[model samples]
Target: MEHSRIAVAGASGLIGAALVRSLAADGHEVVRLVRREPRTPDEVRWDPERKYVDPAGLAGCDAVVNLAGANVGSRRWTDAYKARIRDSRVLGTTALAEAVASLDRPPRVFVNGSAMGIYGETGDRAVDEDAPPGEGFLPELCVEWEGAAAPARAAGVRTVFTRTGLVVSREGGAWGRLFPLFKAGLGGRMGDGRQYWSFVSLHDEVAAIRHLIDTDGLSGPFNITAPHPLTNAEITAAMGRVLHRPTLFTVPAPVLRAVLGEMAGDVLGSQRVLPMRLLESGFTFAFPEIEEAIRAAK
Candidate 1:
């Protein structure tokens, strides 16, 4: 791949940090947009909450990846919390777009972050990039988030919205949180465990991002998930198998609803998403199956 200067917003987050490391390793010049002053010169300070970004620093970049957003699952969706969640994404994306729009030499591509929640609960139906979005707060937020990048697209920049799935990694992410419980033989399915868990390994997540950055033909919403999605029960079983633990403890739906409220719906919702666009674009998946992804993460 040809080396290019890249700017990554939200460079402190899980995906952003990983992408920065990967890009740097791949010989690409990476400039991280941060909320605070970086201890090093490679970082650029930007305050999205304050609506200020260094537009001058953003110029001359080949690509810009926006991964800024509030953690949706970090708190209950009180009306205020929900508003914050929505605003964070939209505001951050809009800031990036505006900054790029003002740049003398704007990036050629803008890869923005989104989530599989954009598709809502697809149940058993396999969804793809071409699939219409579904209903729910998350789906709605994703739609607005993606829409916030319109200025960049209108500026002739090829924009790519990555609707990511459950990112499984041993270091941090959903798998890290579940590892201890499952390892202690107390891991179990949430609700009936039949809901499909669309997932991808962290390795594949970063790989797919790099692929999209390099592949100019790729644009629009691309589902960044493994080809072979599994149900909650299957995921529980697989984790148990990997850890040599029993997979008998099942968290009842009523309990989950009582504890998580609207968030519980996300845990129980079914979304059997497919990466049709990535596949058609000839982007090969490093870990297509759950077992392979799990073993690699393990």
Candidate 2:
């Protein structure tokens, strides 16, 4: 694929930063959309809460990738925090979608970020992108979150909703917390440890986004998880194997709920997701197995 200029929201985030680096390394010009004042030539300012972005600033980008949102598990999911989670996603996505649509020369594609929680708990059932949404606040949130991108899709941009799985990275996300705990022999399975955790290496996550940007005839939702989904016990074992730590401890579901509150359900929930669409589109994962992903994160 030929290199093209791209506008990226949440460019400072874990996946976003990696993408910016990857795109730059591949010789693509990246314009970062920041909330603060722009300090560089490649930065643009936007206020998602107000649905504001300078159309002229994003006028000629080849693609717009919206990865901005409050981290769902960043805090206790209190009533106000829950509102923050929903609003952050809907507002940011809507702002970007409208901005992209309003541009005289809109980008060819819009890669909108979403989550696999859209499937809720799949409990031993292997699910793909075609699976109907499951029940939960997350499923509903993801639906509306993805829906906020309608403007871009309506403007004829090939919009792709990326339903990401547990990202295995030391930088942050699920692995950030897990790595330290496992290094100190403190890592263990949550609940009964049977809940399947569909995951992808951070490397693959960024690569998959880049793939979507250039791949033609690909629109709508694509699952961005490893082909093999590991249960919580399997993940714990993999971590112990990679870190050479003991994996004898197990945290009860009740304990998790008491500590993490509503967020515990997500930790203990099963989401055996598969990147069926991405594989069908000829994209290959660099780390598709638990051990491979864990070792790579090491």
Candidate 3:
């Protein structure tokens, strides 16, 4: 793959940070676009809320990856919180798309961040990139998020929406929260324990993004999840096994609802997503199984 100048928004966040490191290690010149005034040479200041970006700073970049968004699980989905979630993704994406589209030498590819929640809760049925989006807040948000990138696509830039699953990592994400509980032998399934927990290792998530950047033939939504997905019960068991702990507790649906409100659906909803397009593209997964991924992260 040719090393190209890449600009990444949301560079301080989990996935964004990982991508910055990966891009740098791959020998690409990475410029980080941040909200605050950049104090370093590698960073560029841009405020998505204000819809302002220095186009000169974005010039000469061959690719751009937008990962800016409000943390969905950070707060209760009151009307205000819901609006923030929608606005954050839509506005942030639109800002980047407009900036890229206006560039005289615009980026050749735009790899935008999205989520598998776009497909809603799919129970045990496997959904891929081609699956029609289902229902609920997440699906609707993802639709608008992807739509915000339409300008770049319409301008002839190769756009890819990375529909990510539950990215398992020891440093952050759900795995970080679950590790302590499982280690204490209090971790268990929420609700029925039958809901599928579609997931990907942090390693595979980064690799697939890089793979997309290299494979020009790939565009549109690509499921950034492991080939093998597991149900909540299975995930609990695997984590228990990995931590050498017991998985005997169960959080009732009503109790979870009381605690998390609408966010509880995030814990209970099922999304059995698969990386059909990525696999068909000949991209190999470093950790395809839940147990193996858990052990590697541990």
Candidate 4:
């Protein structure tokens, strides 16, 4: 892909950091929109609560990717924290979208980050980008989260909701916590181990986002996951195999709920998501299997 000027919000996040490195490696000029005051040449300032962004800093950018949001699993789901989670995504996305839309030479595309939890519990049934949003908090939050980007779409900027899945990376995310436990042979399935997890390697996640940035014809929701979806038990086995450990233990559903509180529902919920749109667009995954993704994360 030819080098282009791209602005990225949430540049300090796990996925955002990876994307910045990827883009820079590819010779793209990346302007990181930070929450704090800009201290560097490539850093721009934005405040989500105030919905402020300096339009001059974003002018002439080819594309903008919004990944700003509170970490859902960062704390116990207190009502206040939950509100913070919702507000972070909605307000942050709205801020970025409105800013991008207002630019005199607005970005051609807005790659907004979303999640696979939008599908809720699907059991073994496979779903695609066209699948309707499911019930519960995550699905509801995702709906509002994606909706916050409407201004960009309405302004004629192609908006793509990158509905990402469980990204395998030891640096951060769900796997960050798992790596230590798994390495110590404490890794095990949470609940009956039947819940399907739609996962992708961190490498693939970054690559897919870059793909969307370069692909002009792609827009709207695109599921960013591997072709193979694995159940919790399968994932446990893959981790054990990759790390040369054992996966003979399991966490009961009730205990998981008691420990994780309401967030446990997502931990146990099954979502068999597919990348139908991504496949049709001719995008390829570097690690499409659970084992490969687990190994690659190391």
Error of 2 at 54 (Å): 1.4
lDDT of each: 0.88, 0.92, 0.88, 0.91
Q: Which of the two candidates, 2 or 4, achieves a greater lDDT against the reference?
A: 2
Over 142-202, each residue of candidate 3 has an lDDT whose tens digit, in order, gives: 9999999998998889999999888888777778788888988999988999999888988
Tell me each candidate's TM-score.
Answer: 0.96, 0.98, 0.97, 0.98
Clashing residue pairs in candidate 2, if any?
Answer: none
Q: Model 2 segments beyond 4 Å from truth?
A: none
The 10 consecutive residues of candidate 3 with the worst lDDT sum are 47-56
| Inter-residue clash pairs, candidate 1 | none
Taking all chains together, the TM-score of candidate 3 against the true structure is 0.97
lDDT of 3: 0.88
Lowest lDDT 10-mer window, candidate 4?
48-57
Better by TM-score, candidate 3 or 2: 2
How far out, in Å, is residue 266 in model 1? 0.8
Residue 157, candidate 1: Cα error in Å is: 0.5
On the 0 to 100 scale, the lDDT of residue 235 in model 1 is 92
Q: Over the stretch 136-189, how does candidate 1's per-residue lDDT look in tens digits?
A: 899999999999999888888899999999888776667877877887889999
